[model samples]
Target chain A: SQTIHQWPATLVQPVGSPLSLECTVEGTSNPNLYWYRQAAGRGLQLLFYSVGIGQISSEVPQNLSASRPQDRQFILSSKKLLLSDSGFYLCAYERQGAPHEQFFGPGTRLTVL
Target chain B: QQQVKQSPQSLIVQKGGIPIINCAYENTAFDYFPWYQQFPGKGPALLIAIRPDVSEKKEGRFTISFNKSAKQFSLHIMDSQPGDSATYFCAASQITNFGNEKLTFGTGTRLTIIP
Candidate 1:
């Protein structure tokens, strides 16, 4: 069985501060990773997705960016956060050829002050 | 053209009652449709999914009714439980350019089961 892990279950940051969220998947190799954000009372919006290491495709251009540093490790970062950046961030993974089923991590709650 | 329109942003139902949620899409290229359930602060979990070729699929207490010609799909819950109270999201995806599939989600329907 494969498991996905996300760090800093909850975070509180002020505007202009930097942000970093990490996601790691175990028991899978060369999986497709994705980053999604959900605002209060809104559906999820895809932020970024990666096919392989050092390859990322952004769906919505924003202050946030994503990186695949390792095969199973993905990181979402921002040099300076904005008030609009506050939301629930999720990490998801799917097998390379199998894009139908996407498994999600617990998720990180970010609050910008 | 990439939107999946969902109706009844919120629904309230009594325990043991059946709750139905509907969604429609505009993109003909979309071949996969999935429904997710999310608790208050947890990530959305894959509840059920259906392909265009199938008209209906049932798993446990959940069922999905799909209409390919109408470009619409719906989720049905049988003998609903209070534990099923959560926000339901409907999403559609189509394989575009190099096996990369991007999903477009609906506005989400918040389902409340009153006990």
Candidate 2:
């Protein structure tokens, strides 16, 4: 069975602070990874997706950016955080040739103050 | 058409009652519809899904009713339980030679099961 792990389960950052969240998947190879944000009382919005290492696509323009340095490791980074950046961030993985079923990680809650 | 619309932003039902969540899409290119369930502070989980070729698909206590012509679909929860109280989202995607890489998610419907 495959498992997804995210670090810094919950974070509180001050404005203009740097941000880095990590996501790694185990038991899968060359999986498609995605980053999504969920605001309070709202649906999720896709921020970024990667097909392979160093191949990233931005779904929406934002202060956040995503990078895939390894086959199973993905990182979301920001040089300076904004108040609007506060939200629940989720990382998901899908099998390369499987159906569009997305398996999500536990998620990270970030509060920008 | 890249949007998936869901209605009844919130729903409340008694235990053992049936709760229905409806969703509609504008893109005929979408070939797959999926319903996800999310609890507080948790990631959304795939509850059930259906293909346009099938009218309906059921798994355990969850069911997805799809209408290809109408471009609509719905989720039916049988014998609803309090544990089922959570936010539900409906999504649609098109699968091509590349893959269904992106999914358009609806605004979401919050379901509450009163015990």
Which residue pairs collide, candidate 1?
Answer: none
In terms of docking quality, model 1 is: medium
Enumerate the chain B TM-scores of all models: 0.96, 0.93
- The reply for model 2, stretches above 4 Å from the true place, is B96-100
lDDT score at residue A35, model 2, on the 0-100 scale: 94
- Candidate number with greatest lDDT: 1
Roughly what TM-score does model 1 have, to 2 decimal places?
0.96
RMSD of each: 1.3, 1.6
Off by over 4 Å in 1: none
What tier of docking accuracy does candidate 2 attain?
medium
Model 2 has a clash total of 0
lDDT of each: 0.92, 0.90
lDDT of 2 by residue, A15-83 (tens): 999999999999989999989998865688888888889988898988999999999999999999999
